[model samples]
Target: MNSTLTVSWRSVQLLRILVSGIFLVAGLNHLIEIEKTVSRIEAAQFKGFAAIFGNLELLVILSGIAMLIAGFSFMIGFKTRWAAIVLLAILIPISITIQVGQITTLGPLFKNIAIAGGLLFFILNDIKTIKKQKL
Candidate 1:
């Protein structure tokens, strides 16, 4: 590849790492605050399953694991696009439900949108590569 292309690739990989690292840190912290986290979820009026959400210690653990794997893939630029898409899929809805309408805080809402945009960048760029591979 040309030098310009190589630099562009490296920049994309760095962006992916930065985005995924945020998810990894947040997910790991969730483990330490499962009860409080669940309470917050409950407070958000997530609906129809308050008790189930309160007991989501296991799910919190799994989410942390997913974030770590996704973060590593992003950092290494291996399946980077797939990992970003997965991260966005898992985060966006939860962000909207918990942070957007409920919180109404500028920081949280904008952060979510920014992360979503980052994942979209990865996905769209990679889709072009994927299409080439398919031909």
Candidate 2:
């Protein structure tokens, strides 16, 4: 008697699209509001981390490009695990550098953590399909 609840593939696709939404919007924000993103990074409590890369603008541009690419890949469900890995790679440090310090930012911090958990769901499971595989 199999009893585990099963999700429809359409629902899984919706999850993928929803999970990628933040990254897609954020990537556009980074490109469209480059100055805004930079100034926020500049004012971060651990701002000195920028010194490690030297050119803050260049770093922001690269990250924005990466986010756009990874987010697209994630939404389309192509190479989903790799997309999750790429997103997680960029997300963890950005979360620590900006969102970890301020009480006002706590909501966003937990949001990033939740995003990581979503990505991890892909990372830990072979999610190509919703149906069970034959042994």
Candidate 3:
């Protein structure tokens, strides 16, 4: 392999690790504090339909699982396009409905936004790969 190609691969690998680590930690943390997270969700005065989701923890768990799976796929560059799409589908709503309104207490909503952006990048990058795989 050319030196430039090796460097590019290394860069992608590092990005994958960073993205995957963030999702894994966030998911594991949610699972660990499922009750607390649910309570917080209940307290939020959301103006969207998500507030009607009574079993908030279930949603959180499902989203977390999606993130975990997507993150892993991203790290390995395996079916990354689909994984990124699923990850975005799960994350975008939470960011728009939940995190955006709580920025004062949440300090910053950039993390989720950054994740969403990263996932999009991965999806675009994997487009050719996905097509090659007939996915």
Candidate 4:
């Protein structure tokens, strides 16, 4: 490979690390501040379906755990496409439910959209890599 390609690859790796680190810390924060997270979920009025399987708190905790798993998988480049998909799935609902229609939350809503876009790009790139490997 060309030196320029090598540099580009390293830069991409660093970008991946930076993106994945955000998720890791967010996941850890959810776990560490479970009560606060659950309170936020409740404050957001996430009750209906979330209450079906016991309480909204449990669902929030489960989502946090999923976030942690997906974050780690993405960071280590293990099943990266699947990890990206998982993160996208998690982000979409949270974005809609928690980050929408508030002046204070507009930033978070846009941030979630950007993250979802990145995850989608990651998924497409992984598919292209797989095709190349098979060729």
Assess the local accuracy of residue 125 in candidate 4 as a C-alpha lDDT between 0 and 100.
71
Model 4 agreement with the true structure over 10-122: per-residue lDDT tens digits: 44455566677778887787878989877776666443434445666676777789889998998777888898898888787666656763447578888888888778867
For model 1, how does the per-residue alpha-carbon lDDT over 46-127 read when each residue is reduced to its tens digit?
5224344444556556666777778678667788778887788668656755776556467887888899998888787643
**Candidate 3 regions with alpha-carbon error over 4 angstroms:** 1-7, 52-54, 105-107, 127-135
Per-residue lDDT over 1-135 for candidate 2, one digit per residue giving the tens place of the 0 to 100 score: 955556667766778899999999998888888899989989998667664766778778888998999999999999999999999988987887788866575899999999999999888777865684333
Best by TM-score: 2
The TM-scores, one per candidate, come to 0.73, 0.86, 0.74, 0.77
Clash pairs, candidate 2, are: none
What are the lDDT figures for the candidates, one per model?
Answer: 0.68, 0.85, 0.69, 0.71
RMSD of each predicted structure: 6.4, 4.1, 6.4, 5.9
The per-residue C-alpha lDDT of model 4 at residue 34 equals 84
Between candidates 1 and 4, the one scoring higher on TM-score is: 4
Q: Show model 1 residue runs off by greater than 4 Å.
A: 1-7, 47-55, 127-135
> Cα miss at 43, model 3 (Å)?
2.4
Off by over 4 Å in 4: 1-7, 45-54, 127-135
What does candidate 3's lDDT look like per residue over 1-135, in tens digits? 633211254556566677777777767777778887677666655635465654677887877777777768866878877877877777777667667778686644688878878887777664443222211
User: What is the number of residue pairs that collide in model 2?
Assistant: 0
TM-score of predicted model 4? 0.77
